[model samples]
Target: MNKLLEVKDLNISFHTFAGEVQAIRGVNFDLYEGETLAIVGESGSGKSVTTKSIMQLLSANSEIKSGEILFNDRDIVKAPEKEMQKIRGKDISMIFQDPMTSLNPTMTIGNQIMEPLLKHRKLNKTEAKHRAIELLNLVGIPKPQLRIKQYPHQFSGGMRQRVVIAIALACAPKVLIADEPTTALDVTIQGQILDLMKDLQKRIETSIIFITHDLGVVANVADRVAVMYGGKIIEVGTVDEIFYNPQHPYTWGLISSMPSLDTTEEELYVIPGTPPDLLHPPKGDAFAPRNPYAMKIDLEEEPPMLKVSDTHYAATWLLHPNAPKVDPPLAVKERWNKFQKQVGSLNGGK
Candidate 1:
């Protein structure tokens, strides 16, 4: 696959009244053409910050300390505002988390979807409206002609999300960034939206950057997964590798914390301790304090990403050649066992 977007040595910070908060620390990753890449992490883990930077959507208080965001051979970080205005919705589109605030309640759905078509494609009103209805229909909205004429309030929550997706896909962007687009929906709606996105990708041939803290959500959707923590990508691998053969301790914690419906346990496991303080970013590994498998070296130096496979890499001292071999927690092993058992049963007990 071709490299569509590449982020190298990306460092981002936010200037606040308290101090300069380091949001992204030397983050690096790649998004290939026609693939879904899921960036998973907690709320403040910089997943959104990194994706926002690709769209140049960071606030005025934020700064790109140093790095390059290469999209189609163009450095987006250095692109002027005028150039970015041309790139925003036409070249790259984003489906934000919340649909309620994302849409203008006053404007009809048709006009909202047509806004991008009018601004980017320079289409006439008739042409734009035609395209808008087509978009609404494409996203599985029923009676596009009548629905487009109605306000956002007239539609259900799921319908409003479909409208958001329609607007995002209106211009046929090369890249689509979905920042936890399913976070607000129920499980069934989430599944429908995921299916819709995968289907749309096939039809449009657009790369997708899916951001979420939910590991279970991306299981069937993502081709590759990047695990973020303390404002950095701690591990990255193919979906199968990350879920079946994780290397990072933090990754193990996340896997163990997944809520299992088959199990009788009602209390979902939580990763203990708070995330690292970025205002005074740690000198050593940021997750050292929280990592049970951490060693003396973890507190003294940050570990570089060690290659586990051609497609898998993780930043942890435990991956060091000289570090101690620590076993993953029993809960994580049990979870993996349950998954394997389920897979085996589905395969006719093979």
Candidate 2:
């Protein structure tokens, strides 16, 4: 796969009345062409901040303290606002979490989709309207011609999301960032949106950065997974590796917390303690406080990304050569074994 977007040691901080909140502390990742890379973590774990930086969409109070966002060899962090405008909806685009707020209540859906086409693609009115109808149809919104004229209020949550997607894909963006795109919909609708996005990716050949806290969604849509915690990426691997061989304690907790298909347990496993405060960022491993398997070194020093495989890396003291061998929780281990067995059987060998 072609390396399309590269983020290197990206540090982001927000200057608020409280203090400087170090939201992203030396983050790094890469996006490949025509692939979905899911950024998974807890709500405040810097998943959104990191991806938003790719589009240069951080707020006024936010600062890119360091690092580079390289898209097509162009440094996005250093790109001026005038240049960023061309990239925002043309080269890269975003689908926000809430479709309710993403769309304009007063504007017709057609005009909304056409706005980007006109601005970025510089299509005239007649050409833009034709493409708008095509996009509406492409996103599975029925009766593109008639539905195009309808306001955001007329569409259901799922339909509204399709419109939002249409707008995001207006210029056939090279990179598409879907930040919790399916969060606001029902289960059925969520599935539909996921299917639609996968379909669209194949059709348009766009690389995707999918940001979400839901590991289930990550499992469904991601080619690779980057698991973040306490504003840093604690683990990253191919989807199969992350699902079947996750190494980080936080990744184990996240997977174990999901409601199991085979288990009828009423209570889900929760990771103990709260996330660390970014205002005063931890001097050691950021996740040490919440990690049940945390060692003395975990509290004294930050762990580097230890190599598990060429495609897998995890930052934890447990991955150290001198550290004691400790297994994940029973639930996590069982799930991992089950996943391994499933893959082994599919490969027709042990």
lDDT of 2 by residue, 67-175 (tens): 9989999887888899999899999999999998988898999899999989988899999999999999899988999998989999999999999999999999999
Winner by TM-score: 1
lDDT of 1 by residue, 108-135 (tens): 9999999999999999999999999999
lDDT of each: 0.92, 0.90
* Prediction 1 global C-alpha lDDT: 0.92
Tell how far residue 59 is off in model 2, in angstroms: 1.4
Q: Candidate 1: where is the Cα deviation over 4 Å?
A: 264-267, 337-350
Worst 10 residues of 2 by lDDT: 338-347
Estimate the TM-score of every prediction. Answer: 0.96, 0.95
TM-score of predicted structure 1: 0.96
